[model samples]
Target: MTDSTAERRHELSSFLRARRERTSPSDVGLPGTPRRRTPGLRREELANLAGISTTWYTFLEQGRDVRPSLQVLTAIADALRLGEPERAHLIMIAADETHPGEDSEYLAPEVADVPKMVNPNPAYVTGSSYDLLAWNDAAVELFPGAIDAAKPNLARWIFTNPAARDALPDWPVVAQGLLARLRTNAGKHPGSPRFQRLERELRTSSPEAEAWWPRYDIATSQAGAKRVRSRSGQEQLMTYASFHVSDQPEQILTIYRPA
Candidate 1:
């Protein structure tokens, strides 16, 4: 098998195991058992719930080369009670098709100009790996030196930069959410050298990153409110929304406004 294929399978296995281990029997309406070797539903129980053979499910969790139909995957997803982001990630990593924009590094000139158009709103655009591709003046003011770095990555900044911690009042919560989103992106682009390097860096440089990396949590960028400490030492609430760039789905444009 190709390296990317192997990496994807390994990730799929890990994801399934993590999700299964977190789901309790009571959560699935199964009677709680006091005597169990491990938490969550067993392989056989999950297979039965999804209406599949236990051996097949075992093979999947073992990272064997097995192709499951979408219907079967959907059944497993439903049985596991996966949220939207986690369910989408499961299906994406299981498919054999190559991801769009996986190999492309080109950013269109017009697309690069979008952040500037939303001036004064602290707008910025990031690639699939959360690398800063473009930003407005407001973004520069909001996140000093982040966009000016040789290779600025928002994930790296959130986890490793002291300035980020100082700026974000709820640093731990924000960091965890960003890491979860990064995990979701990693599912889409397995065996990517960029992601591998970033993960290694974060794991080495940040204790929280290392602690949370194995949890297999997944998230998507969505509208939310954030609390930030201004330069004047006053806490300010900001509302933010993220959008995928048209025809360039891998690029996300995010804008923030005062809440």
Candidate 2:
């Protein structure tokens, strides 16, 4: 197998292990044994619950050459009690298809002008890795140095930058959502070098990031209301929505308007 394929398989195995370890027999209405040595449900128990062979599940967890079908994946996801986003992430990780790397998508001219077009409203465009590609003047006003050419990562800025707490009054909620988005994207793009780099940086830079990374929470960007601390020291609520760029679905166009 190629390096990328191997990496994808390994990631799938790790994701499954993490999910399995977090779920307990009691959670799934299974009998709890007194002498159980495993922290969560055992591999064999999970396989049985999913109606698959224990040997097959073992091979899958071992990152062997066995490929699972969508039906099997669905069963396993149900057995593990995965949420919608988590199930989607699991399917992406387990797929054998070859996905495009970073070079496949580029910021088009029209796409670049989107943030500028949405004037007065705080707008920005970010890549799948949450790298800030473009931002409007309003976005900069709301977030000082948010449009900086250097240090433009949303995740890095949220976790490591002290000013983030001041800008985002609801820091805890926003941080969790960002982390969940990262987890979802990581599964979709398993071999992405940008993701690997950011993962390392987040895990090393902030204690909160390190603690939350293992939880494997997943989130998809959608329209939502956010509360921010304005320059006048007043709490301002803004509504935001994410738009997908043509041919570059990973390039996220986010626009924030007064709520």
Candidate 3:
């Protein structure tokens, strides 16, 4: 299989495994068994609940060449109790191929300009893989040298940039959150070259990042607060909100405001 196909298969398998692991036997109305080695429902249990053969489900989880029908996917999703985003992502990965047309990764000029419009709020736009597509003056002022990296990769900056660690007082918390968000981005767009490149770079360059990657912590874009240290060495809390760009669904507009 090609790299894209292989990536899709890997993502599908990983997604299934993650979701399955998160769902417990009790959550699915099954009795907890002491013999269970895993935390969640076993493959056989999930297969039985989904009305499919254990062998087939196991094959799917193993990233084997198996195409599950829509009905089968829906059944498995229900059995795993996937949320709407998770369910949509599941369907997307299970598909043979994504829609072919324009490049979904491309951020339009208007979309890129969105951050500028949000001025003074420290707004920036990130692509699906968390690449810094665009940012306003406030973002540059707040993030400092970190965002001006050669690649301007958010994940890279979080783990590798000394300035980022200094600027964000809660470095460990921010780094962990960034890693979790990166994992989510990777899962959502497994075939994205940008994500793949960043992943490889991080794995090789940042030991801290490599160690945290396997946790498979998934994070969604949401409003939150961040504690940051200013250039003057004064610390302050900042509240941030994430907005999905309607024109470019893959791009997110994040604005950080003073708390």
Model 3 misses residue 243 by how many Å?
2.2
Candidate 1: where is the Cα deviation over 4 Å?
99-104
Candidate 2 similarity to native, TM-score: 0.92
**C-alpha lDDT (0 to 100) for residue 29 of candidate 3:** 94
Residues 1-259, candidate 3, lDDT per residue (tens digit)?
8667778888888778877887889998988877878868889999999999999999999999999999999999899887776677678778888432222367788888888898878998887777788898999889878577765867778777788888999998888887877787677665676677788888888888888776566667889999988888889899999999887666788899999
Off by over 4 Å in 2: 34-36, 103-105, 149-151
Which pairs clash inside model 3? none
lDDT of 1: 0.88
- Candidate 1's error at 7, in angstroms? 0.9
Tens digit of per-residue lDDT, candidate 1, span 11-79: 899899999999999889999888999889999999999999999999999999899899999999999
> 2 or 3: which has the higher TM-score?
2
lDDT of each: 0.88, 0.86, 0.82
Model 2 has how many clashing residue pairs?
A: 0
The TM-scores, one per candidate, come to: 0.95, 0.92, 0.85
Tell me the spans in candidate 3 whose CA falls farther than 4 Å from its real position: 99-105
Model 2, span 1-259: residue lDDT tens: 8867888898889889888888999989999889877778899999999999999999999999999999999999999999887888899889897554573246788888988998999998888888888888999888765556464878888888877888899999999999989877877776777788889999999999999988877788899999999777888899999988878777799999989
Error of 1 at 212 (Å): 1.5
